[model samples]
Target: MAGYPQWHTASEQGPRARNADAVSAYAAAGAPGITFALADGVGDDPGAGRAAQTAAAAAARTPVADGPVTAILNAQQALRKLGGTGDAVLVVAMPFTGGYRIAWVGDARAYGWDGSMIRKLTEDHTMAEYFRTRRQPYSPRMEHVVTTSVRTTTAPEIGTTEVVGGGLLLTSDGVHKVLPPATIDGILADPSRAAATLVSTAIAMGGHDNATALFVEPPEVDVAAIVTEPFPTAA
Candidate 1:
């Protein structure tokens, strides 16, 4: 079996009166990998913090054998069961043999850092991104408005991707929004303090919202062992 990847996470309420972000990571029981999940609650909702905590915990508990997409859908269901006026964006990453799988809803983001460059792995589900992709003009306010969230009445259109190589990063808008991509790349260059530095820097740079970051070093995969392992039986 392959060893679990090393990871670190940091979160701060920042300038916000309260924090509405949650993050979790653990070794997946059903697969030879680790699962990382994060949630950013909608600022306008009163129950946002609890909602984020619930969703992130639910997502992280999902077995990796089921895949990242299933992990996100499970989280959405969990939020609905909570039954409150709370909403949150979510991102889940699961690392496998040669690459990793990521799934997200709303604006929480995932990125790949290959030492020299940082690449965005998930697309924002915000109105601004929607307009930009369609080549339509939109107000700056649209940038903060997400089209869907974990508490939405309808199922969200989850964004997913698979990438090979490099380290992984997951962050709430508080971190990525305040810090430019170049600055993020610079912080990631040193993996030891990357997560803590990312959150602290965001706060120093006008943290109007909560900041959270989770960083994972690439796992050393034993490909031959993975190939020989027995498939998990149906539950």
Candidate 2:
């Protein structure tokens, strides 16, 4: 069997009274790849933490045979079944043959690190982003107002991207929002310690929200070898 890509995760409650972020990863059943999921609960909601936990677990465990987008949709359905005012933002990443696919909603983000620099892979689903994309001025408060969430009755507009090379990262807003891109790049410079460092540093830098990070190193061997069945081609 071939070795799979290495992965690590770290999460911290920071100064918040309660943590409302979740992270999960799982090997694809009967497939050659793995899936990573992260979710951030909407702090104002009473059931935010539970929603984040449910979304992250469901997204990570969903079969990747249908792709990361479908996995996120499945997670949304799971959140609906939970039936409450609970809401969360989510991001999912899955590696394929020579690249990987990422899907996200709200502000939980995906990033790629290529040793030299780190680049954001998913866009924030917030009013700030919407206004920025339209070249309109917006208040700073808009940044905190996400346009959609896991519990939306209507399907939210999900952000997705496919990329080649480099390591992958999934982060809750607590980490990314507190750290500058250059700071994040510097931490990722040491992939082995990236996850733990990211969470700790975010808290140190005055991040009061729960912080979470998941890092996946580029595969050292073909991911297909990890499974008994022939590797399925990514759609």
TM-score of 2: 0.91
lDDT of each: 0.81, 0.82
Error of 2 at 57 (Å): 1.0
CA lDDT, candidate 1, residue 207: 75
Candidate 1 regions exceeding 4 Å error are: 28-30, 44-46, 153-156, 222-235
Top candidate (TM-score): 2
TM-scores, each model vs. reference: 0.89, 0.91
Q: In candidate 2, which residue pairs get closer than 3 Å at backbone N, Cα or C atoms, i.e. clash?
A: none
Stretches > 4 Å off in candidate 2: 44-46, 153-156, 228-235
lDDT by residue (5-82, candidate 1, tens digit) is: 567789999877689999976554445665789999998355899889888888877877788888878888888889
In terms of lDDT, model 2 sits at 0.82
Candidate 2 lDDT over 1-235, as tens digits, reads 3466877789998877788888877774576577788989998455998888888888877776777778778888888899887889999887676767888889999888887788888889999999999999999889889997777624447778977887888899899989999999889888889999999999999987889998888777655346634332210
